[model samples]
Target: MDEQPETVPEPAGGLDRRAELSEFLRTRRARLKPEDVGLPDFGRHRRVPGLRREELAQLAGVSVAYYTRLEQGNGRNVSAEVLDSIARALRLTDAEHAHLMHLAKPKQHKKKQAVRTQQVRGPLRQLLDMMDGFPAYVSGRRSDILAWNRMAAAVFGDWSELPPQDRNWARLVFLRPEYRDLYVEWDQKASDMVSYLRMDAGCHPDDPRLSALVGELSVKSEEFRQLWATHDVKEKGYGVKRIRHPLVGEMTLNFESFRLPDDSEQTLITYHAEPGSPSAEALRLLASWGADATRAGTGASSR
Candidate 1:
């Protein structure tokens, strides 16, 4: 008798990869206009929004049929060069570009790994404490408040009072009215937070904790749901964050978010105001208040 032939199974996630790629491309395309991409407009009446397929193809130096197939989810094994071209045509930021590449070529895994633990090293906590003038905190991959200094608690609100699972930036931004009102540019800051989380989601698609956070925010906050739908991606690097603290009034402070070398998933964010400025004076005032609270054994929880 002849031996039977065996068939190899398709790669995991093969069925859904095209669908995800299709949606990502469509969303990116919808955010741009022909004029924005330097294309001449003939005053044609459009049925849909954003740059047309032909316009994108021309800009990306690819054939219209090829680009159409890509957007239609029919393309396979898309080349790196082509993906880079498409990313440029879409005017993607660094983080967005990386996400595009990730969508184009997803890594294969046998099973989704369990969410990694969020733990802060002792030395890192010590370092945060040493920054006497600045508000410093360490956040895990999902922007979970793993550890924070006294000043951070004073400035960003005391997280110690909340359960460990609830010590999350997204939760504070969306659920706590006091925390929401604390940001002078509340809408921009909220959008940025969502975008940062979106980037993390793309990188760690299998993290159950991340999925739960996203789901909770979607159900609880309409704004979060809308922003998440936009598919924006961003890394929280250096920026000037204006705050309206109940104790310190309004102040503009610069912040720097640094990824810890020891743990790539952890980020250390610190904030400072300009020297001799009113914001700086406010920081000093807060520090004095924090010191007083510490002496009274009420630090990081009085609020």
Candidate 2:
């Protein structure tokens, strides 16, 4: 298994790890040839791991210097197309591919979920507040629910109802019995959450708060601890989740996430179905019930 460094707490010498990232990547690039990525081995002994920088540049249709700059972390304005090409040439696993992109731009700081960053500018908050009919939420790369529209909060659970610290959707899913009760496929969702968090952690191995969150969750939830050990990685953006909501029982919802053009780390997710569909109806009823329940000091009833 590949070992990633701890998310926070740098070497005592105050060296810039960001600068070292490029060097580390170059070392990873120096050792292989075409054969590693299905090019004939040609019976050669290579000094590097996967591919030579020049061979990878050729395979990825890039200049050796450009690839070298990227590996050295000196390149700027690295586009997604070039990143994708490099990903394929390196035969990066799903997690490694994402980590590569993250390493490509190590300067921008992504805050922990619930922590505000420049990504949630005032205009975006206004946009979320304006969408009152459907459930919508903004999530970061780590699937942290950065912000939620009123309906979204209601659909998941009353965010304001919980203490400020416990508002994270991912943490709630595994740690709180209330949110756990809503998932129709609880175990599946739990496993998905762990695997997804694991991948995010990999891409952000040097993020302090992310490490703390994982550590806290691991110690607090046995299931989380158990699931984290699997090392399974998945790339999921849009998916349907079945939930037996405390407000509405037995409903299926489809969600779509659109990446925010302005803030690269942000993606807004919306859930919807046809107007007359049963799921839609359930959603409407839940909204009203959750609204009413909020006033009555009773939890919303599950459909």
Candidate 3:
């Protein structure tokens, strides 16, 4: 019988840094072919897929022994120049290169330092509320829904109804079926969430809460497990989302994400529809209905 894959313990604090680095490098390497990198492919008798370590080393202008050590997860004492060379050799995207750097050279956190709760300033909260027609929300580390306006609550369901811990994109996307139905492209949404989490993990490998969240998601959602295994990383930025609102029917909205300058970890995201489009009309209708629902103490509850 085939051996079962090893499972990381649930609720553990943080990921194993070295292991994460190793797997990330391996996956990145596995996705490339020798021919893609101007290397000769000597028949199909290879024992493993993709370019071998030696081939990668040749492409990166590094010795096979040195590249092997780096691939084995010993990123210590490695310079940024070497990482740049390897990233170029791997043909990594900008986001992937940043993630690789984060994994290999994690920020040192004080073991005794307390975990501070993320809070949106009153001014920022007011800014969110002022964006009357746009659906706006502030998301902190781990995609926690920090603060949101009535429009956001209307478009994305009332986050106020959820407990603090449940106000996370990872939980809402993978654990709640309503969200799966909300996104027109559910698979893309799911993949995006996992990629965001992976990027966060690279930055905060010693974060206990993040580790617990990953562990919980891994145990509860097989889809999360598969995505997590891919070791993908993405930086949240401007994008378009096609949403199927229960009340509004179908609407395509463009979203912009801005990382707060004062606190880089907190991002302000807002959604808008093209002017005079059907989606814009739908959003206006939603805004009106949402205001009425809020006054009646019955917010837009997902079906």
Write the number of the candidate with greater TM-score, choosing between 2 and 3: 3
> Rank by lDDT, descending?
3, 1, 2
Which pairs in model 1 have colliding backbones?
A: none
lDDT of 2: 0.64
TM-score of each: 0.87, 0.61, 0.92
lDDT of 1: 0.77
Q: What CA RMSD would candidate 2 show?
A: 8.9
Best by lDDT: 3
What would the TM-score be for candidate 2 when compared with the true structure? 0.61
Residue 88 error for model 1, in Å? 1.4
lDDT of each: 0.77, 0.64, 0.84
Cα RMSD of all models vs. native, in order, equals: 9.4, 8.9, 6.8
Steric clashes per prediction: 0, 14, 0
